[model samples]
Target: MITLDHNTAQRIVDRAMQVIGHSVNVMTPDGVIIASGDPLRVGELHHGARHVALRGESLAVDASNAEQFTGVRHGVNVPITVGQHIVAVVGISGEPAKVLQFADLVKVTAELMLEQTALLELGQHRRRQTEDTLLALINGRAVPQSWLDRIGFDLAQPRLALIIEPAQLPGPDDFVILLMRQLELSDKSLLLAQVAPQRLLVLAPIKPASTTALRSMTEQALSLLQSSLSANVHMAVVIAAGQYIEGSLQGCYESALATMASGRRESPHSSVHCYSDDPVTILWESLRPSWQQQELLRPLQTLRAHPRHLLYVRTLQAFFDANGDVKQCAAVLHLHRNTVRYRLKGVEQLTGLSPFRLPELLHLYLALKSDDLSTKQ
Candidate 1:
């Protein structure tokens, strides 16, 4: 039997009173008046309700018999049953003959509401449990084997973890549902959970296919997510190398975080970035700021004060792109060969490093790449 607390019983009593246009009382199985239209009657014991709950049937009290029962009034009391057990008693306080017609209706409505509330509470409890389990799994906590078996999650296969940070936090259930719909993923294939208010972590196994085919599929999935979630959201994707196993999931998570941080610094405009596609940028981003500002970048610093700083930088980039071919550099820059030679001479004078020397060229190239990363930061 489900005991009726004061708050829930009061709601049932109030709602019954509204429908019947009469005073009502809600009692627990033990006959204590948890709720009643008459405030003074609350907490009082009613023998008529106790009899109705014990007998599992409706009990009608008339003026003649009302005095025989404790706190009894001329009314009709019906048992509120869920399944086969009587859990509560709902009564209409009025003449027995007059209120008897509405007694069954009020009892049925109250029971139905209670049943619905119970189901909703059960669902919420299960969702919270599932969320806790997933949080443990992602946080590197050792989950019990029984839990994994119950949930039917196998981590032996290669998996990719995508961490999504939304501009506005979404409800956990809504975010999973929308993501699945957008990605065309089934429950068996994708695992989605909200790890934080604004962050959602999704893990899915990489299907066995050719490298090219897998790459294409991943790109299409990312494109769909960007188009669907980009209304006010920025999304970043990080894919780990193949042959990933269960023990490596934490490493994959770390890689995803690094990728997200790097993407925010380098490719903020692009909604999607994969770790495997740009390892150089990711590695470069990991270097300390002090190490990034090496002596190789000193030559470029001198040009920063010049009015034609951008022009000189472009010329040097073009020279590297042309592989030291003066004709090719001129063609790429839309400049005469003489102009290209003159710019290279100016670069040598400013840096004391000739572009024709292999070591100098290599140093200049690395310095330019380092500078690009810094600028993006």
Candidate 2:
């Protein structure tokens, strides 16, 4: 559209003025000065610039010809041509002959700067598109072939998903770059996106190599990220790596998400979680069949319907999270040891599953985790 914003115009003038040693003016196609080394000249009309821009040529003014235009100076005004368009005009202010020598130089400088700006804008746009495509793929949406091809996404290739949740950090765009740099520092490929404001998703390829190797590499890169963030930024992060999958990415993404969610629910102190840490629980939370989910929740039905359902559930969760330690659970819940034991007994009587027995404890734990995921969903 040939819309030269004031900031970009000022930057072009600043860059060109450094070399020309004279005031430089950047004017829009209609001859209104958008920027100039002499601030007072900004927003003033430059007749010579308008003529040069309209004619697609250069105009020189001198003492003899200076009176031809109002508020015109003795300098050369040339069109800043970008591709086939004359987006703006550059006027170097000095003696006509002296400034004439810098006419093409200033013009070329402005055009190069404009081109660089365009390239940067294009790159940012493409990066946004890539992120959108990655998000759609993770969400199991059918992406267009063109979009997949644009970002070089291959559904048939195995890739593990890594979900990153950071607190008190910079905006997603900046953090994504930081993550990219950190991964690059470890000499790993970058295929990541900011799927949410506080979350990032990285797709790590597991080609001919083993998932274990890729996981190790990811762990090292994230460790570096943790150190970097802790040293430079006031931020804390939790990262989860999902299992490797090919042909589809939804399961992998869900696995990473579930890993993070389950980790935070079960062990909030942990900063890093991998799918292998508790694949059974993670998978059960995400992929359990409706029938299976109903069956699992059946044990908790009576307890959920009880008058003190929330208390019972909270105590049971605290106990399981404490690894079946009544004292630890009591401490965590700020309850007495007997109160904790009493609550466990209440949960067992209501749910028909004993929290004290190992086998029954497993069932109760799974049921609790399943209920948690279901409620969140």
Candidate 3:
């Protein structure tokens, strides 16, 4: 049952008195005054309010009739009904002829405030449940079967995991409301939760053989969200899609996070990243032994100590990206071909791995990725 608390009652009284320029009393259903502009009247039994609450109708107490009941006042007493239930009574103290005009306005205001509070509380309760359900799903833990049913979570449905990293956001509550509105997550196919202050996790349903359609849907939603948030919050929202949850759900979550980290390193300027975009990133993400990555990055250690380390590294990465095409690498970097060659030669000298040799260049390219993977970890 929805019942008015003391704080809410006092707020109603304060607001009503402010507007109507008269003392106000908020009373429980049983007639005891819970809040009053006149402090002494609080805790007193308001017979006029009791009449309205009991009858679920407005009552006007006049000076002539005030003596008919105990704790009487000449005022307009109206029932405050919330969701079809008369939860309380609001009484405005003045001559009945003068205060009766304000009765409807005050009653409506109180009911609206009560409804808003209920909706906020209901949304919070649902959000907590969603967070718990998503946590259990991603962790692959067994939740009560009833809990799963309550949330309408279909365990057998294939889902694609996505991790969203927003550059900044408003307060958590405000941002969540914004997300829900902009993302159009009312569809049961999409589930979202704020796992961190700046991070959100989404699990979207996917067809058995139509990952392309799923990606398109995700991209559209993210694009819409980015556009919607750009004016108020951020435009550079990076989202990364991990593996589909066919095997281990926990592994899917880990891969999605790892994919996000890789995206930041490999495609910082891009808004959306996917593990499908680079199979090598997935391989790097799955590499458990830190020593393997350390050993792979060993060749770059010498080159990293160089004063022009970043220049050499960029040159190597561009060279590989250009498929060893000197002109293409130079064009991409906006540097002269000879300068690109000089940087590559310096990298070869420092690392003892020639960028001109296919085998050594392959190792060097792997080392660059290793450097990225290790740094992100």
Clashes of each: 0, 0, 0
**Clashing residue pairs, backbone N/CA/C < 3 A, model 1:** none
State the displacement of the C-alpha of residue 148, model 3, in Å, after optimal TM-score superposition. Answer: 3.2
Summarize candidate 2's per-residue lDDT along 11-52 as a digit string, tens digits: 998898888799989898899999998899888988888888
- Ten-residue region with minimum lDDT total, candidate 1: 236-245
Question: 1 or 3: which has the higher lDDT?
Answer: 3
Query: Tens digit of lDDT per residue, candidate 1, span 168-271?
Result: 23434465445544443334455556665555566666654565455654454454444444343343332222122346666556556666777666666655
TM-score-wise, the better of 2 and 3 is: 3
Regions of model 2 farther than 4 Å from truth: 1-3, 15-21, 37-45, 54-57, 67-71, 83-85, 98-109, 167-189, 208-236, 287-362, 368-377
* lDDT for model 2: 0.78
Residue 267 accuracy (lDDT) in model 1: 64
For every candidate structure, what is the RMSD over all alpha carbons to the true structure, in angstroms? 6.3, 6.5, 4.8
TM-score of each: 0.64, 0.68, 0.73
Q: List the residue pairs that clash in candidate 2.
A: none
Q: What is the lDDT, from 0 to 100, of the residue 296 in candidate 2?
A: 85
